[model samples]
Target: MNPFLLQTEVRLASKLIMPLKLQLRQLSLKRFRLQLRQLKQTLDCT
Candidate 1:
């Protein structure tokens, strides 16, 4: 395989992966926030 081709493929893969990483990070943060809210509600009720 050509070196340039390999590099290009790697760059494309990284570009694709970067957005997924950002989305996953955002989702995890949202989930964390929800969990904190739920915990606070439970504590308030108790």
Candidate 2:
């Protein structure tokens, strides 16, 4: 229950989470772009 230890743990957790969040965001953005491209192609075909 030491405050310093708690702070350190939070800092470490955030450091680990930041990259994962960035990666997830990038993945979702790529997926969205792919879907958009597919939609445009379908529209063009019609």
Candidate 3:
């Protein structure tokens, strides 16, 4: 139960988690772009 050790653990966890969060964000953005493209195509067809 050391404070310094807890801080280090938090920092390490954040470092590891940040990239995964960024990747998830990127994936969602890509998915959104695909949906927009499909919507545009459907609109054009109509």
Task: List clash counts for every candidate, in order.
Answer: 0, 0, 0
- Report lDDT (CA) for all predictions: 1.00, 1.00, 1.00
TM-score of 1: 0.95
Give the per-residue lDDT of model 2 (tens digit) for 1-46.
9999999999999999999999999999999999999999999999
Choose 1 or 3, whichever is better by TM-score.
Answer: 3
Candidate 1 lDDT over 11-38, as tens digits, reads: 9999999999999999999999999999
Give every collision pair in model 1.
none
Least well predicted 10-residue stretch by lDDT in candidate 1: 1-10
The sequence of per-residue lDDT tens digits that candidate 3 reaches over residues 1-46 is 9999999999999999999999999999999999999999999999
Worst 10 residues of 2 by lDDT: 1-10
